[model samples]
Target chain A: MIELSPILVTLKLATITTLILLLIGTPLAWWLSNTSSKSKVVIESIVALPLVLPPTVLGFYLLLALSPDGFIGHLWFYISDTPLSFSFSGLVIGSVIYSMPFVVQPLQASFDMVGKPLQQAANTLGANSFDTFKNIVLPLSKRGFLVAITLGFAHTIGEFGVVLMIGGNIPEVTQVLSIIIYDHVEVLEYTQAHYYSIGLLVFSFIVLLVTYSFNRKLMVRL
Target chain B: MIEVNYKYKLNNFLLDVSFTMPENGITVLFGPSGSGKTSVLNLMSGLGNDKNKENNSKFILNDRVIDDSVNGLKLEPWFRNIAYVFQDHRLFPHMTTSQNILFGFNRCHSELKPEVLIEKFKIKELLGHYPEQLSGGQKQRVSMVRALLSQPDLLILDEPLASLDYTSRQELLPFIECIHKELDIPMIYVSHDIKEVLRLADYIIIMDKGKIVDQGDIADLCISQPLLTQQEGASFILDARVTKIIEEDKLVELDCGETILITAESMRLNDKIRVLIHARDVSLCLSPPQDSSILNCVPICIDEIQTDENGKLRVIAKIGEQTIVSLISHRSARQLNINKGKQMYAQFKATAMIK
Candidate 1:
């Protein structure tokens, strides 16, 4: 029978990583879109580092940072007495960083496209920044949010190098689908590897297909 | 009065303008394309950032301080309650017409009824349509309604007719006039078009090269300052009261120091109006020609003879207390022996613009 623990762990990790990325990415994206500061390009390049740098390089640095004696890990050890390296939480942090650009770029582009003219118009109409963002900017960037969520979730689910380096193989904890598939292949169990590999392939394809088709219809309507 | 004193620095121009406008009626910021007219409007409404905090600026609206750089206090745009009607409409594209108009009203929690302006602006049918679905004129009408429904203390219209075709501009003029008649809110209208300035200005603030060239009452400025009329050549405003309506001739007789007749159909007896007469239309003669086909001859004693910017001699004259200007050739001025305090009959056609 096909096991469910690895599959559940992968979904859980992907969901948590996407949610955390969204929480931080939104304001960062808004700032990137509106500001003309000198450090804007620097921040943009830093956020986009994940798209170009190998995931193993990022994962290696994260693993070192989350070690028992490392600064972040030492703080966590003092607070909770649990090591961060090879933990599900550590994997979550890694995935969030790895998926940062996927979530931010789309949102920044859409916010930039909505532009300052509309915001200025709203301001004169007695709507403050938050109100205008909620009513005007948010509604207009619906497609951006959808695309960002899909790409972030799917990217994390398909992660291999970063998860292997940071999460390690801990059953029912961080032995996610990508790691399990790697295990099955190493042991020459092609059937088990096929089960997870085919599943992920189909899932990623369906998620992207739905997002793209939905965006097209929305584009036409708008 | 709404007083403004600001020194804003743009890329190529350092704007230094100081002017006061009446709390009511349309105050026009009239100037050419790159004269920092829109820049003034933006700064006055607090829609623009000063960038240079050291530059002192003060804006007082009827005793309430809106912007004071000395105190380092500048009210945000929303806090100022000044609505802006942009030339591009700037309507929320995602919303229907109904939603867009109600967006401001609901946000401001205005006590004014939207339906009144809805019916007045004639946008009731367009309530279900989006801004992209409407025509250029229709979009502007909706934007005007949106701005008015916000219940703002002040409204700024920045060249509302600049983006429209000639026919659409003509079509939208009456709605603009309707706003002046129906609302008591103070408005600052910016336009380079002299026609709009003449038709709508109660107070005029003329700008050129980031400086206030002149500012005063429109009727007073029309004759006193050549900057006001230099666009459409030279023109003058004459204060007159309608004395008679000749139905057969479709003309109205005005008592302006001297009697003048103009072809205005909808005029009543004793109705006070201002007549806009172009100086080019007036011809000077030594004596009043009674048998000529041209109508309305008024005797004007030349106040001064000055050369306008175009190398044309402009004879400034007065009839009673009101002034009338005439653009005559040097040969005609000499032929008529026009000199300071010289009495001459200024004859013109009956197509005077009575407003």
Candidate 2:
């Protein structure tokens, strides 16, 4: 039998979190960059809250929220007669929130840099708002989107406390690489922890190096 | 008709302006810097406005009252049917020239095709090139063409040539002249250069200190002594007929009521030309001098004299039915003892005359 390893679990969580962040964070980033509301500070603070808050704190909130009697969990229970707590889906939700900033900040900065003239010119040329975004905004922000997805996927792979708090190290379902490493260290499995730590360190370093190198190359070309 | 009235205050630079123009021909917003020329264009285009106000400013097109504060009427920039040629000529950096031009025309119903305009504006060679590859003049030309392709009712240009070099400015002038002649859309051309205004503007609006100081025909400003007295750099344009050309001497004689000889390139024998003679180019002599290269000497009576903005006296002279504007040093005025009713010879260069 194949040992459903920590590496496989980490990969699954990263992929799921990256996909969810892409779907949800893109519109949020676009709105944050374009809208001129007075509540911009509040909205920005909320999106960026995960960056400063401890992962355990965020996870604790999610754990409470996803329990059977908790607000979101009760709604889920009413819909499906089961809470998302201790489930793979709960871990995915926690990872998505934890990695949202990695997906959104790059996109916001890129959208802001693109300026209004191109969009204004397109509008005067009779393209509606949606058409303008599709043709102009999306194409121009292609590099930013690439950076966002890469950072988000890599960021979710490193999550520890958030996944542990919500998913509770359930084998085959919630025991990701971070939890496996924590379990190894707690049981004094020094060799396995060292191997997993080196693997994660190398993987994260490669992802970040690629991001910086690609960003520098793009800046020079642009 | 097109009418605009708006007031905006930003960081203590208050811009209060109002103007009305017919819905055809070019109406130039001629002014010096800090005169709020571009601010007026922005107001018309609905680009820059304080968010606090509802932007009740009115812009009327063809008497439809496109914007009216009292009636709570306002149209979005797309529906307003106004096209702006910015000074920087903000072409999309990512698109080719053809794509940029076509983007606007794809929405326009006008019979003016992109191919025809590209050929007419001589941007055919630049169709596949990106905007960064084009020179400043080429970009401005494309900008005008792009705005035209949008088929706007009002074409607004905000100092489009001010950023280009002299040669590029010269290269772009003919295309602007072509558009001025070929198109029926009303244009609001903004420029600080007096020469450009004289060349293209049919109706001139002189802006100063955020106010419409004067608005009239260029000919009227050229002939008015009171207006000339107020101008810091007053010059005159003459409606002259080329009576004869001395091909032997490479000189053309223009009959500006009296004969004014100008050294110019070859032209038709009897072509009517408009000559611009700067006030600084003219000197006063009590009597016509001999053996001087100043060939365009005309005997004239000083009709009026007044001190201008720089505290220098400008003398208005009348030779036959035509008036000539001259600027002389205050000491020269005293040294020559020049005043109204004094007859003096106006000596200036023939080359200074621009046809």
Candidate 3:
């Protein structure tokens, strides 16, 4: 029987994380775009912290929190004995945290570009807030949302250190392509490592190419 | 009635303005640049609450308290039953003409169909077009219709025609005039153009440097103080009885009071038409020249002389109760020794009068 490929785990984690991020990020970005709240700066600073912080620092905190008898682990234990760490779910949580800025900032910037005048005009026209956002703001800022999604997907696929801290190597579960390639190198299996490493290089390049090209077309249309 | 009493300071300009406008006709707020005309429109529209709050004023509309500093009553813009037609014609670029019109309807009572308005505004054919596709006049027409479709209690036209070209303005003026005459809603029209004010306003409010310099009926204000000098320079409403059309000279003869003055351009023999008389066009002559270039010289008494801000002399004359203005140099004022109780001939430069 053929062995299950290790890369499938990373793909699943990236896809799920991207979907979750889009759901939460769209509204957060919309709020950041339209809100007059004085606390916007504070929220913005927090969203941006993940972008600039060392990946290992985030991994260290998440690892401690998700370990058995830890903050999230103990709470999760009340529901079930199984802790979140060293599982597929743990990698998803880590991926989402690591890839958040990629999803949110683009959406916020796009929403900002949509501006207040059009929304106010929409409101004056008898549309409540939801209708205004759906009809006016959404249509206007679609390109920004697309950019956010592309960046989010790409960023999630590239996560390594955070996933490593929470998700210990477990083939078909948590042993993703990056960790698999590392394991291959540690075992002096250079050929297998070369295969996985080359695959990642090509994948990231293609994703980036798609994003930049789409952005170029958007700029041209604008 | 709409009453505004507000005082605010912006940069070096202090805006202290108050006026009570009639509820049923077009009340024009006329002023020069920096006269705070736009500010008044903004305040009335709720787009200017911050400034209005800073100034601490009151705005009452139709006995409904809109902005009252004492009571702390300030309504949101959407709640105000006043539709503002801005000078820029802020049509949503992403929206079609029909969509824009529909937007206005959405803000208003849902009882009326928006298509009825589209038919009324004569924009049915242009509904599918975006704002960028329409001409300036068409866009303005669309904007005006949009404002009206909202079914506002009072329409606010903030220089709606200010951005259009001359021909476009001419095209749109009749629609505005018709709206004022035929529509049920009252309107507050703001403009600095005196000609527009004269043409469209039923009641005029004159402003200068953030103050109400004068306010009254257009015809009465034309004949009254301060405003008269400016009007005189370009103000003559001649009730010309067309005795006969002199086709040879292409001139119309107008009978004003006891004088039958001949104008170069003639009208149909029995038509009574109004013509404007300009003050600078009228010259003072000690005696009427028999063989001269001056066509219409009337024998009259010099009524009085008033000076402008620049101290230029404007000689007000009387040929019955009708007073005519003639601008002369201050040097001429001294040389002619022009005084109130003096008799002089009022000679006019025929071409200075425009419609």
The number of the candidate with the highest lDDT is 1
| Model 3 C-alpha lDDT per residue in residues B60-160, reported as the tens digit of each score | 88888888878888777777777878787877777789888888687667566676667766899999998889999999999888878787877889898
Off by over 4 Å in 1: B245-251, B265-269, B286-295, B330-337
Local error of candidate 1 at A168, Å?
0.7
> TM-score for model 3?
0.76
- Checking candidate 2 for backbone clashes, the offending pairs are none
> lDDT per residue, candidate 2, A117-159, as tens digits?
7777776666777888888888788789889989899888888
Ranking by TM-score: 1, 2, 3
Q: On lDDT, who's better, 1 or 2?
A: 1
Predicted complex 3: CAPRI docking category = acceptable
On residues A147-177, what C-alpha lDDT tens digit does candidate 1 reach at each position? 8899999999999999999998999999999
Question: Model 1 over residues B1-355: C-alpha lDDT tens digits?
Answer: 7989889887788888888889998999998889999988899888876674336789998788999988988998888888999999999999999999988898787889998999998999999999899999999999999999999888999999889999999999989988987899999999988888888888899899999998888888987777765555457888889999999999999999999999998777998888888889998898887699898888888998888777678888988898888887888877777899888889999997765
What TM-score, over all chains together, does every model reach?
A: 0.93, 0.87, 0.76
Q: What tens digits encode model 2's per-residue C-alpha lDDT throughout B1-355?
A: 6788877674446667777886767788977788888778877776665463345477788776666777877676677778888888989877889988877787767677778788899999999998989999999999889999998888888899999999999999888877876788888899977777766776788887777888877767755625443654567777788888888888888887888888877667788877777887888899999889778788899998877677787888887887788887799999999878998899998876553
Give the CA lDDT, 0 to 100, for residue B42 in model 1.
90
Predicted complex 2: DockQ: 0.50
| After superposition, candidate 2 runs with Cα above 4 Å error | A1-8, A190-199, B9-14, B32-35, B63-65, B119-125, B165-167, B198-200, B222-233, B240-273, B285-295, B309-311, B319-322, B330-337, B342-347, B352-355
| Pairs of residues at least 3 apart in sequence or in different chains that clash in candidate 3 | B236-B277, B250-B264, B251-B264, B251-B265, B251-B266, B252-B265, B252-B266
What are the chain A TM-scores of the candidates, in order? 0.97, 0.93, 0.92
> A1-222, model 3: which lDDT tens digit per residue?
123467777778888999999898898888887677899989988888878898888999999988886788778777887778888877887888888889999899988887776665554444567877887878777788888888888787777788788888888888888788888899998888888888889999988798789878866554
Docking class of 2: medium
